[model samples]
Structure formats: structure tokens, C-alpha cells
Target: MNPAEPLPRAGYADVRIIAASPDIARRVADVLRRCFDSTEQRSYPAGHDGGTRLQLTVDTAHPAGPARSWLAASQPQRADRPQGSEA
Candidate 1:
């Protein structure tokens, strides 16, 4: 399979494993976490539920070595206007 290939799962937006190594995966994850700060339930609806709900995978099995990076399939959900409704 190619790096451009999609993951083997259902109901996902986009998923891809780019790195190849636990160290690299950790590095990448750190970078992503820093970059994608506020991507968790704690930062969500202010004591409501979840946040940037995304799913990712880090592979750890290869001839060369363990795989790194993550593949995720997710979709974002935002609220709309509540007309003629109680708050």
C-alpha cells in the first residue's frame, strides 16, 4: 500500500499513516498536539461534552521498524440557531 492510500475502516473523513517509528510518531504527535491545541473534551462545550472529536492510529509493526504517525477518520459537528425554543 502507498502512503496516499486510505485506511481500512468505515465512517471516516480522512485517514493516513505518514511516519514510521514510535519515536517519530511521538514527535509528530507532540507537534500535532501543540499545533492542534484545544482539541479535546476538556476544551469543548465548557463542561458539556466533547471537543474536536477525531480518531487517529499509530502503527507499530514493520520490517524496517515500528510505524509512526496516526490515521484518523472523523467529522466535526457544530450547533445551529435554535429558533422559537427554550434555552
Candidate 2:
């Protein structure tokens, strides 16, 4: 949740870790276990036959921090100019 901290895990709603860094991976498993019933937490993987996995995955994701700063710089602010200095 914190920018300083990296996201090394994914897919907690489903029973699969998808990808893990092996550092906070055990924490990820704990989160998934809490999200689902304890029984389901014990079973199921990426895709299970006759089972449902929401298939929620991230692809082509970019960090928004730098993008937001870039966009902010492009906006026109009256403070940038003084008394209609230039066009």
C-alpha cells in the first residue's frame, strides 16, 4: 500500500499466489487464507476444473507516481507568469 514498499504478490481473492517474491510471499498466503474460507485456503490453484477463479490479473501496469507528476507540470498555473508577461 505504501509507495516505498514494493508489491511482490498478487491474487489474494483467489487461491493462487500468481507471482511472489518469496519475501512477503508467506504474508500473501496469510492474506488469501483470510479472504477465503479456511477450507478453500487449503485447496485450489491458478485454475481448478469445476471451480471458479475470478481471473483477476494485472498486465501492463505502470506506477502512477511519476505519471501524476508529469501531468501536473503540463497544467497552466497563473503563478508561473506575472501580470500577463508573455504569450
lDDT of each: 0.34, 0.40
TM-score for each candidate, following the candidate numbering? 0.25, 0.23
Per-residue alpha-carbon lDDT of candidate 2 for residues 42-64, written as tens digits (9 for 90 to 100): 32243433332222222212313
Report the error of model 1 at residue 37, Å: 3.7
Across 1-87, the per-residue lDDT of candidate 1 in tens digits comes to 479876644332232223433445445555544433222211112123321322343222211112122322232333674556645
State the lDDT at 41 in candidate 1: 19
In candidate 2, position 56 carries an lDDT of: 26
What are the clash counts of all predictions, listed in order? Answer: 2, 0
Report how far off residue 54 is in candidate 2 (Å).
17
Question: What lDDT score goes with residue 55 in model 2?
Answer: 23
